[model samples]
Target: MAKIYDFNYKYGEQKVVLPPGKYLLECWGAAGGGGCKITDTNLRSKGGYSKGELTLKKETALYIYTGEKGSNYAPTFNGGGKAMMHEGLSNGETLYCNGGGATDIRLIGGSWDNEQGLLSRIIVAGGGGRNNFETKGGDGGGDAGGDGSKADSKGTQTNGGKGQVGLDGSFGKGGSAVSPSSRENYGGGGGGWYGGGSGYNAGGGSGYVLTENSYKPAGYIPTKEYWLENTSMTVGGGIAEENGKAKITLLQGLPFLVISSYTSEQAVFTAGHTEENKLSKIEWFIDDVLKEAFTTDLYLEKTINYTLEDNALHTLKIVVTDINNMTYEKVVTISKSIMPLPTNANLQDISTKLTEIGEGFKNGKTSIINILALKNIDSSLNNTLVELSEKIKALFDSGDASIENLMNQLIQANNTITQLNSKYKYATGTTEVQKFSGKANMYGGKYGNTFDRNINDWIKIDNLGFVPNIFYAEHENVTVNSVFYKCVVFAICNIPIFSNEQDFTIDTSFSKEKLDNVDFRAAGIVCTNNERDVYINQNGVCIPASNNYFNLHYRWHAIKFI
Candidate 1:
């Protein structure tokens, strides 16, 4: 059997001197004041509360600070008080509990700022938000705290929202905001831990009256009780009894759990109880069935590898039980698809091959046809590279690809293509200019028997020079309905079939929609010493609309002379 002692504090700093041996410590924060309205109406919010345990040795002095309630004011809303505890006196490594914000028509409940280092292990309850004509007050703050009260909008006398009740039975409710029958009537009072008071002369409701004493509300119960015989002792407003039973208090803080990293194949997570020493067991579960249980420690670190068959979401849960049979549980949902994991060596090989192919194309040592003809390469590797490349390209086109993964795959593909190109070399020869003819058509016009010269003789040998460059441009600045001005411009460039030797024939025909004027015509291809220019005419006038914004589609065919 162990001897136990309990001490409680509120409103200020309390210094306690203890004798040697192990002693458990517990604490709670203060509540906030109500808001002040123009008509002597007061609306207040409750403060947050927290509890934790600490072990102390003999002759140790513990410093405790209980926060004060928020002040009631008209211009600014008051914030809830903060509770804190620290060892020694210098305020080093202190634990803090934040207060709630004052009630306001516009502002929600006050927030809790957990102590920096102790946030992971501390249980904090936030103050309730304000309730007004437009919105309800915010629910009590914390993971499992009670919901705030809802606004009663039935008539002039609307009930305020209820405050949330915390695990320790602490409650923070909203004050009623009753509409005044006349300009002289007062508003309702804000809600507190006990409850709200009724409005004065039609004022807002006063804080809920729990016990006869306004200082002590209901649900403020001691976590542990100690009975000492023939001794006089005082604890936080209540007197210590001389009962024979002494209880040990275990400090419970908020649970901290997180998923550090996750992928299609595996997920790594970590979970722990704030009070490490009090933790008795940690159990891991998936979807509901228990997967494993750890009984040695209070903390949990695990990695789960799962198979994703349909790419559906999965749930992972962790349950932690303390020495006092108190348990905390958390669950996380993960969604991912199975992705092929390529080795670094394989990626490097592919990258090397792609580089070779790129260099071969750049130096004109090989063409796309030559590289496509290579054989004896790994089929799976090639397919994987192609799939990755297409997926990466599509992601970029849609503006959704992860850049790091895309770049890595692209580098590997580039290397693989380079290596494939090294196995084949196409014969290189001089490029001879060849004559060719093709037909060009547009939405409202056509040019027949157009002739051009191909600079690459391989275009005739391989019959692979029929690439087209077509584009459309609009001239919104020039507002006119005529075909010469307001109409869209269509242009064609880089027609591989061309001739510089003489003026080639270009018979033109225009549809009625293309040109309202029958006299509208186009200048056939005109060859120059350096370049060629094509022109169009409306009403027998040559319109230099080619330089303006216009749509163009250019393509050509090569007559391979085998």
Candidate 2:
């Protein structure tokens, strides 16, 4: 069986020698006392606790430093407190624990520091800071072990000290003030190694305003409690001796579970223990549901990854058990949300679409303005095209046929069609034309040829000939006192006829209509004379006109420029 040792005192350094064996080392740092007001009773504060296990060799020496308690008023005029520790007297590289600070009027509570060692395995609890005069009571200490009680401000009697036992273990309490009834008041007691003691306010003592057998302040008494069962361990005030050697038993500290990293999608957790082979298992739970469990050796230093749902609150609980049947548990709450991180594939897709749009616009295959307008009208590209198609149909249905309006509509339609064609990569290069072939008569009665044909006879051909362009039929009529003659021509390729271009030609011949008997018998007149005058116009039409009686024959030929 392993022997146990213990140590508890106000302030001292003691050396202990141990043989080769496995042993547990436990330590508790001292706490600072609460500051006192001129008229208020001073209070006492509590300290922190640290423990670990180690293997010792033959002739190993360990130096222990017990921390001192906070003073009522003397040390620094309502100053702070301190904690205890153990050090290697030879190398001075050993485990250390810090105590809570003392509270002054309106000062903050003492802060706890992390334990220091090779394993870096202990956690220190800090004491509470003192309150101001206007405030009623002092603040409580940290929850690492015990919580300190608040002071009373109502009435003349001073309030009692706080309790020691906290959620983890026991620490110290704040002191109380004196009463108004001429009774002596005492400050709260400091925390011991294992447990913390309460403050006292006893009667029948002499001090300030000394009266025989009057109320007076009493000295502080250290308190201790047993944390473990079936062990020879003693804590609190005064040192303990066992088998002519100092007996000290250290409590096993809980393991540390830390969140290494966290995000909306995943979270990483890490667990660690101080002693090797002391841990039995580690279990993880989320929202009361078991996620994973690990059964492994002690001295755990493992990390775990957990996937989380988006935009939700999650609770994580980690339970660790040691080989000694000692268990430690930790819990954390985290909220996750969706992260807007674009993937490579998404970016690539967007880039490809944009490239296509840019190339189409640059090559004039796409109308950027219309496409942009369509895009503005609708967010979806496919839907924008559908809406544009509907709008175009509506535009055409309005039945506005003015040349200017029609031309504008034609331009818009061209742009829209071009854009659509580029988007779908359609082929629209082939051209088709409809030809026109028809004949019209020109009336010679309007001219001086004595013909019965009308002069206003005309014809029009759209998209005609090899080029399938436009052609218009034109005729000129002339009359001289009941005799009429006319010229007919066709304008081809374009509406406006130009001079010297033989677009199409017309030829006409005429016979004499009547002969005069006196003109024939005259010496200068020949009865057989049937000569007529023919004239060609700028539009390439031959016109025949005469005073003689004549009939006419007409023929036309189409000439292509290209």
Candidate 3:
């Protein structure tokens, strides 16, 4: 036994520089103190990795150095607080976490058993993409799933052993026809080192976390009138832990800023692959042709990054370009999901995906001075188009068809921008609209419409064939002098699946939590256009539009197609 840091430790349990004397270090496995071994010179076990520090010395009577952690439990890896080694370290002493984190982890004189914990960082590799529509699930990615490391074992990966990240979707054309329950038959993303993949074919996975102290901010977080989609963030370890075969090896220090909820309407596109002098460099291919080659650095964070239309599904392929330009192509597909429309949309919506607006305007074309959100009319955008169109009446009543055409253009632009922006916020710009250079329309791929996996953004409709915006026939116009032909109105209604069910769970202090389910519907209105008036009594039919949310009613007029 030796007196190190004034604490008595068993032989071989820790190593030290000697007076050239023969001494052995003992084992301090789980059998040791429940976690960090504690010598029971007085009886009973104590000491834990939670907040324990170690100090070591040599037999020369002169202090060789502080004892680096020797695979002890309390000081497992990221738990080493202060007084850590940074440069020269003893056989069992180490400083500076390899992955870049609070200097934690130390070397044990014993063997390589705990080497995985000795490193400062860890990386959980991605799992292979899942297969839907007749495709075998792609093999879990190398190191991507973080299985190369050992700590990710089941028996070993306990305490949620830091799961692997799900892989990106594959671009390989998933078989036609949405596979059973899949929204899109796109290949699923592979599991990465930290997250679990979505169970359903095209689902996403839950992310994992490993940190110095813990991942969450201490205490209760209050919810407010927030539009933020998600706000949780976490740091990760680098060592990919392995069990007998090394399960999720957490490489140790991976960068932290990249953790995101990815909730923006527009999502950026990114591609990544492991680096090194392997079979050559990895490369990317859009459809078939090569785009980029991979390198050893490819394994590092942020290999590829670009903003893409949110709610749009995209397919990309990656291949390793050898020094000879030989290719090892791998497919990666990225798809974005639409955020539920906000009752009152505003700036500062929190999302994991970064979104960008087109070069034009915040609310779309300048022609549309009014916003659909302002019009209170998703219910009205697709309606017959012109029941109570106040703006339409203003247009044609002037006896100028040109003005009527312009008004129709404005409505079309507003509706189109709303739906399109809601789907692909990145495809358009948020810059304010200051002027209108005349009438404009949108076509092909513009306004983010496409059948192929490649989703397109808004295109300005200018030339005879090109209009940045398109008109809704139901929103057709009948200027003052123009005739109003009676047409049946098929309007949409907004309903509350459940009226606010206010549940009050009271203690000494009363607290009320109200849960509301908002429901929207399209109900056919057989009334003639002439009978379309705000007063329900004048119409042959009437339906309740009450869910009681701020009066529970939809505004804006339904219209008739030209």
Candidate 4:
């Protein structure tokens, strides 16, 4: 956002200190008070306007001088010439009005005292001159002061005052006129960069701008106006009719903080203001507590612990201050989901319960053993169990060794299969190869050719649905003198594919004896993101001086290890 400061008519010179930034300055000079004659009225000329741009440093002090309008009897403020009294008038003394003062901005300190003070003026607007009998005062100047209605000449940058009889105006004061006789009573000149000449009616002062981008509007009668094209500084004219005015508007803005991206666990941000100033310091805060402070760098990538409590939320605050001492801050809310942990009793209680359960189980097993012993007294049951056990043992000991050998063989086969599975496992859990090919038109490579790829020459191989881990391309040129020219390019597409960085390698082999005139310079291959298109450089002169195969045929194959 831009800020504006205005300076209106005041008693004396005013000063202001501005920070480092670009600014537009505008000033309007004051108009002289009207003068009257016997049975006739003279019209007062309006003030001239001046505008330009300036780039100031920090703590730059500027002095503003708002012109004060001239009056018939009182002395003019801010360097307007005083009126002259007519002599040899039998009907009492007749006094003429004085010239108006100029409005300007001065770099050096102190009031405008002498002509040497003109060196400190950065910009100035000319004031209108006093009027004469039935003759209107001239308007203020853009480059040079306007001539007075009387026999007085105008002032300019080269010469401050131009009239012989008129009191020559200096840097801040307007030229005063001499009234030798009652018929020769004239008004004073207006004040400006160079004060105007004085005559029966005074001349307007000259306006000035330090830079070339200044502007002065057209049609001020005697004074010519000028304007530069294509600039932010707008038009200027006789806008100020009474007292002069000055305005300073800031063109550039201050710095502010921006959060580029943020997540529950990570955040990326920048402390950037205007291009004119750099950041002085940056502080990061979490939940109202200061976390870290940085000075040199404006960009930061910070990790946050949002999962401190189950389903917890955290507040992130970033504050940045620029070199101008202007500060800005931003706050963001982030949250993370966390699983709750189960609560359990003390360890001693759990151990006691386990011991009781184990003792009961042991006692129950003993009771079962005693009952079985009592039942063993039944001779038939005991004999049947013993016979069944003997049969099973005899079968294994006699000829069942073959069954044992078969079991061992099965175990060995299972162990061998497990080893193979361990050695051949895929990291991605899939081993699928997708292959596709197409035909393309390309120019033959030239000697010392550089790889310059064009987008239009690329061939799209889409609908694969998945990004390939690796890419392999084989291109074959048409038979040159009945010999096939082959090029194989292997590329590893960057993750997300659209990244600027990509890696690929190309290999071309040929016998020098076969085609000595042909030069295999370079081969370029690229696979674009999302579209999965392949682009190859096709800008090169054809090889072999005898062959006119400029449009070489190419068959490309794209292999994707899915």
Candidate 5:
């Protein structure tokens, strides 16, 4: 049996002292503000408990990352870089860099008038590559500006001309604008009339970032910074509109884990964004101890090898400064389990199953969800299979007719898919399935590509799990007149969303008589595939008459009677 270390939120960062006697570990997590709860908490906490304080165990740190990312109901183990990179918000997915850790890196919030964000490094909101009869708006995005042909190569420049509204039509769009200053790796920018090259880290217009504030995004806060480089949002290249705005803001940081203990000739991390930023130079260290430094544009990613010396448990922190000078830090510890059988085969099998099902579905072909769901029960995966078996049995039960049960089965299937997060392109790939276990396959680089995964991050998009916003009433199921106060004072925090509840509030006022009248109003959640809507008391689902709630009396719209 493993020892359990209970957490309590008492300080910003907490340290636990254990007895000398060694014991097995069950579950452990880092305590940020004092002794924090390992489970979940109110909206005031955002319940993003990611940092794992390993009490001597293997996979402990990784579990923390998984938990934190899943806490928001996000499916991506390593984020989509949504916390800091708004350009990544194209799919409205949240991701994080497993490598860098820059100082004072905060999220700025905003929104766009467009249905989705037209954000990229070099967005072209204006006209581009237009002529007599065959021309239109410029390509809008980050890294690359609007080039005529649509090839937004980082170094290669493109020229597009504006179309003439009257008389003679305009010519090709403006030339490609390459970031000559950056001689390093960059994402290819799209083409447009006034186009730029593709490059990662190059903030684009209408580009988005995920950050929280007193209120929500698109709500309008003129006093806020709505545009700039590293400012969460950049101007779009050429968005068509008299002044049509396409705003994108931060939802939260992508969840990530750092493996500092496995530093080989190269340092490495397990993240999805690494492919986005192909690294060339790697600066590594351990507690200020200079471990190594290298430069190679072929693949700027670093790798961590499990060496004999690293067999012992030792705290290690590696700070990687990518080409953009954006530094990332990952802290990891060596575990006792030095060697183990790689599950690449099992993971690949699962991926293949999903791919087949997805392809069949997309092509309007037949799909056996039952068989697909059974793939999760591969006997090789012991415990998980057992748990799933029980759930599957429930699916056939007479009570399975209920919508809740059906939805629960889908949720279980989704969770099963999540377990297939072994590696990207495990088998089917033009390139040898990027060796994440042995090489630096986009663990941290912005130029790294986000390969196709078995399950999409969309499963956990906007996954700020069941946050109970403040309702005027404090008890269990709140009321309608009080529904006006759901997270009103404080926008439910995402990344570090809440410093403390004392910093926020809601409109809680109900007269004793009015409160009595406020019946049948209950707080609950309505679930979709991955998105969940939380409604406080008296909002939607009315509380049953047999309400098991902590009822009380108060002055209607009561003010602190001084």
Candidate 6:
């Protein structure tokens, strides 16, 4: 059975630590409140609805926030705006109403009520705008927010705009009505990725979806007809009611185990799974006897020791189980044999065989032993040449012609092994590359800063499982001395991605772009690439820049050959 997490109307953001797996996220926003003294509640605008798929690389935290229904007295909870009121007017006599709050799901570093958290919002459902005495509030949904009936203005991707007479809105916060000399009051705007515009009647908020691979629902109001086509569900489909709600469903796959290698002494194995957290346990067995058990870990290693004088076939097996109680197993067989100690009788038998060989040579009977007869021995044995040398020495001491043939065969075998080893060292065609991407925050130091660089001026990324040879990095929207600047940084290390570096070249090129009052202009400036400063380390990659007294946030993507 799939795991489900449901959330209702909440005042603040809640935390959910999801296991490593794929999931489906569904959200619904709240509806706006009607104007003061207006009993016809059906005129209130409906909130937006959003549903999509989300994937987690590991166990991650997801911040969930549900919207609150708008009321005439106070501001709506969770990013809603407050209704405007004149100094001399009361609530019952006012013509204003508050906007509804939005429901959203935020990824890493997402915080409620913070504009900086907008960068982490992956899915959002916009709230409806408030209603006024003359016109109705706008309905929330679509790529952009809907305009109010009388406002004639809407919310955009960045920020909200003002209508004929209202205050402008910012990210995640709705717009409010403007103050005037008259006694009249206007409605408030809705909350969303970008809040709606404020006017006589407010505009609805805009919905947003940011996912690598996802399916967007067809209609603004989710229906059973479209839910069946969009997701794996055939039932339970609808929009949010007065308050907002959210649901998360986890997707699971079958668990598997692969035995990488096994010997009479030790065994090594790895589990096959994309979602590492889904695996529950691993059991190791030798000769059908359980040896060790591991919990919630994929890698398995065990050591087996044979008993005294034991010469028999041994068995090694491993079983893996998932959270769903599904199991998979693999088995391998190995042999354990020991040679017996030489005794007096064995020595006498060896002496007799040597004497017989000498007598046969004297009788003029030439016993031509074929070199191919030795092929029955294990070819994988590394000591094959040493054993063959001992046999050739015995035959040569007896002056046999077969010794010359054996010596020639050993030379040919050694040449074949040398050729195979050379090909294996340089063999290459196509290989998959492992990818890693993340954001790093750095502070600038003095120019040409090498050893005296501040600790915060650079970032060292390690435990990446493998070192990166190629890097694509860029710092955007960096505010330096009250000016927003963007720069692109690209680097390549010429060496094996997974191997230790002896002598490597690091070529780093950076391009700067300046934005003065939104008029973007590109300026090409080549930064010197110093190998002593920026080079691939045995642990991972270290990235640094030569910016003086600047604080910047950069995103980087690294790829290494698998």
TM-score for each prediction? Answer: 0.26, 0.23, 0.17, 0.41, 0.19, 0.44
lDDT at position 6, candidate 2: 66
Q: Residue-wise lDDT of candidate 5 within 473-499, one digit each (tens)? A: 232234554432221111121213233
Q: Write the per-residue lDDT of candidate 1 for residues 1-562, one digit (tens) a residue.
A: 3444443323222344543223333222223223223222222333323322333211334333332332222211122321121125343322211222221110011231212211111122223333222223222222221233333211011122331221111123223333233321122222222222222211111221111221332333211222111211111111111001112243233344565665656767765544446667777766567878777644657776765453443445677676777566655443343122233334445455444434432332111211221223467565756565456445544755453544465576666565554432222222222333322221211235434432211112232222223322223222244444332333333334443232122322222323455664443222211122222211110111222222322222222121
- Candidate that would win on lDDT: 6
- The digit string of per-residue lDDT tens for model 3 on 279-331 reads 44555544344555545564343345444443343334444443434333333
Q: Could you give me the TM-score of model 5 versus the true structure?
A: 0.19
Worst 10 residues of 1 by lDDT: 235-244
Going through the candidates in the order shown, the clash numbers are: 70, 45, 131, 1, 128, 0
Give the per-residue lDDT of model 4 (tens digit) for 307-378.
334223345678877777767776654434311111342223323322332332233211101111111323
Instruction: At residue 375, give the lDDT of candidate 5.
Output: 28
Model 5: CA > 4 A from native: 1-214, 217-280, 286-288, 296-312, 338-562
Judge candidate 1 at residue 174 and give its lDDT. Answer: 27
Return the TM-score for candidate 2, rounded to 2 decimals: 0.23
lDDT assessment of candidate 1: 0.31
RMSD of each candidate relative to the true structure = 23.1, 37.6, 27.8, 31.4, 32.8, 23.8
| Higher-lDDT candidate of 2 and 6 | 6
Model 6 Cα lDDT, one tens digit per residue, 87-195: 5665546343777787888753344776545555767777777777645677565456667865544555556746536766667767877756557666677777667
Whole-structure CA lDDT of model 3? 0.23
> Candidate 4 vs. truth: CA RMSD?
31.4
TM-score: which candidate is best? 6
Would you list the C-alpha lDDT of every candidate in the order shown?
A: 0.31, 0.31, 0.23, 0.55, 0.24, 0.56
Error of 4 at 276 (Å): 14
Better of 1 and 3 by TM-score: 1
**Model 2: residues with Cα > 4 Å off, grouped in runs:** 1-248, 251-253, 297-300, 338-562
